[model samples]
Target: MAAFTATCCGRALKMVVFLARLVFQLLAVYAVVLLLVYVCQRSLQYFPDKNHPGDPKESAAPSMREVELRTEDGLTLNAWFAAPVKRDGKIVVMYHGNAGHIGHRAVKAQHFIDKGMGVLLVEYRGFGGNIGSPSEQGLYKDGRAALSFLEKQEYANAQLVIYGESIGSGVATQMAYEIQPRYLILEAPFSSAAAVAKKRYFFLPVDWLMKDRFDNIDKIGGIKTNLLIVHGDEDSVIPIELAQMLYEQANHPKEFITINGGHHNDLYDHHAGHVVTEWLEKQIAAEEPAVKPEE
Candidate 1:
């Protein structure tokens, strides 16, 4: 009986050692996964070249003039510019999301064009068949170049509306902070890239690992332009809560529209574009002085 008890204790000790080894082995494998995620994160984030319907610009009218943007970094980018249908109407400088190029948004541009507002479909470097690899600062340079082009065309800050979608929201916020466009609009925006990544990759240390930290929340408070935020409650990509959190950080003269059951890319199908443009048109009209009853 004593011998049998001793034998049982020895077996229990071996089982414990095996379980400990298994746990360590699992930990080692998980560490490797974390390292890979850190290294390949950028590739996972920016989708500059996405497969889409044949030529995003094919549906656009021939009147749309293709222009060149010379960045401060000395890179030349291709952009499409459509003059406002009515002279002196507000111009929308569109900074689109990460995936696909400006060409993917010709239909969206037509929304504003149909509204008689000029649309400058700003194409970031490495998108829309342009040159140079995209980075956080690179996109800012692209945004600046777009504004500079308009300035050269004699457009004032009051005549420009900076519009950002998805990742472009950071670019738009940054530009608004610097120049204070007449109005600033964001669609499906995130507080920061780090914040969104943390939600998606909770197991990984995304805050320390991410290189391009598009921190919009810290800068949105500094922008005093009339702001509008459009987000879909069912948005699965950036999450609607992120937009709400960003809106909370913004100053007054700001508005938010939560599209019910709206997903990340289908907001336009729900007439979000028409709704946004109409709101801005009203805001612009309201700010203008009323016609004199006698004069």
Candidate 2:
């Protein structure tokens, strides 16, 4: 009876150890899956806005001129250079958020133009009517391509501003670090994509699992341009605190606009284009022009 009792205890101990090992293995696999999901989502950001038929048309007239551009990677990008009715020299290279083509930005573009700022709305490769797939690198390529398109036009009298919304913030931040624009405007921007992922998956070890940094906090400091960050106080999609964090990470000559009753989607619900355009104009007025090299 004693030997039998000892044997039973040994078997139970072995079973417990085996189960613990199995649990550890499952956890390891789960961590890997989370990482993979982060990578896939980051990769998909490149081609975010796939063309969809029956999308709502813009309220603006057909005043904007359509332009085609090609990135160095052989991806074609579509752009609309909406010239103001008065053809002002100021140009805004605007980047729409993660999930919409340039067409969806007609209201924003019109607002900029109405403020005497020409708007160059770019379509990332694989988004909208553009060709090729989107990756983080691909979006950066498209941004450079958009800058190149505008530079070739010698819009010398116009000041260049970059406006990036949501996911476009990463792309715009990257560009702003590389080139000196008049101002860098980020709407609903996150400090980093990794940080945002961690928030969404609090239980998961997302920091270790994420592959794409999209580290705006690191990039914002290198930008010398005036910075404007806009976020709603009650933004649910991206918490208002993240916007404040982004602002804190930035350097001097930065401003934050707290939109009252502004949810992420309804920032301009009441003011429509009037408020944004006016804010942009104020930003432009406050900025000192970039110093160009001697001719």
Candidate 3:
């Protein structure tokens, strides 16, 4: 009995040692993964297309001209600009999702232009044949450059509508909070890049590993402008729950719309443009001064 007990004890100790080594190895591998994630998070997050988005004239938006916007960082980015139709007189500054360049957005942009709203399709650094790399601060500089161009055009904050799509919502949120545009619209926006990364990389320590937080949830409260949050009920990319969370935290004078079967990129096909146009017009009318009958 004593000999048998000794053998069993030895076996148990060896098993424990093996398990400890395995756990240690896994932890080491995970740490390496985390390091790699931290370094390459932006590359994974921003999927830009160096290929031109195609010509605006080809996209049926003949008024949009290829223009150069100078950033505070001294980088001149290629952007699309169009003055609003005289009837509408509203300038819409659009920051597109982090994917194919601004040209991919010309179709929806034309919808706004058709409504007589001027649109500025701002392209970021390192996107659409523009020079430089993309980062949180770099994108902000690009946004500032867009606004500066508008400022030079004599457009007031009240005449401006700031729009962001997907990741671009981060840029839009920051700009709206800073400038207080007439309306601020976000489509399929994540609460923050860290939150989205955590969703996709549940196994990793994303909150700490992510360098660009985007942190839209934290900043939404600071936005006092008229806010519009749109999400698709079936949005698989950035779940509607995230949009709901954002809307819940937003200030009043805000609106939230859920497309019945909207996905990340197809909201436009689901008549999202119509929704935006209707809401913008309603908000504008409500804010317009009442016309009293002449005495």
- Compute each candidate's TM-score over C-alphas: 0.91, 0.84, 0.95
Clashing pairs in 3: 84-118
**Per-residue lDDT of model 3, residues 1-295, tens digit only:** 9999999999999999999999999999988988887888788888889876667777767789988899998999999999977733888899999789998898889888888889999999999999888999999999999999988878788898999999899999999989988799998998888878778889987766777788899999988888998999998889889988889899988999998889999999999999998998888789879999999
Write down the worst ten-residue block by lDDT for model 2. Answer: 52-61
Screening candidate 2 with a backbone cut-off below 3 angstroms (N, C-alpha, C), the clashing residue pairs are 89-158
Of the two candidates 1 and 2, the one with more favorable lDDT, higher being better, is 1
Report the C-alpha lDDT of model 1 over 1-295, residue by residue, as the tens digit.
Answer: 9999999999999999999999999999989998887778778888897322234347664446788899999998888788777667799999999888877778788888887888898999888778788889999999999999998888778889999999999999999999988799999999999999999889888877898989999999899889999999999889999999999999999999988889999999888988898899899999898998995
RMSD of each: 2.3, 5.1, 1.6
Q: Which stretches of candidate 2 lie over 4 Å from their true place?
A: 1-4, 28-39, 43-47, 52-61, 85-88, 270-272, 286-295
| Alpha-carbon runs more than 4 Å astray in model 3 | 290-295
Best model number under lDDT: 3
Residue 57 CA displacement from its true place in model 1, Å: 6.7
Error of 3 at 169 (Å): 0.7
- Relative to the unseen true structure, what is the C-alpha lDDT of residue 177 in candidate 2, on a scale of 0 to 100? 90
The candidate 3 region of ten consecutive residues with least summed lDDT is 51-60
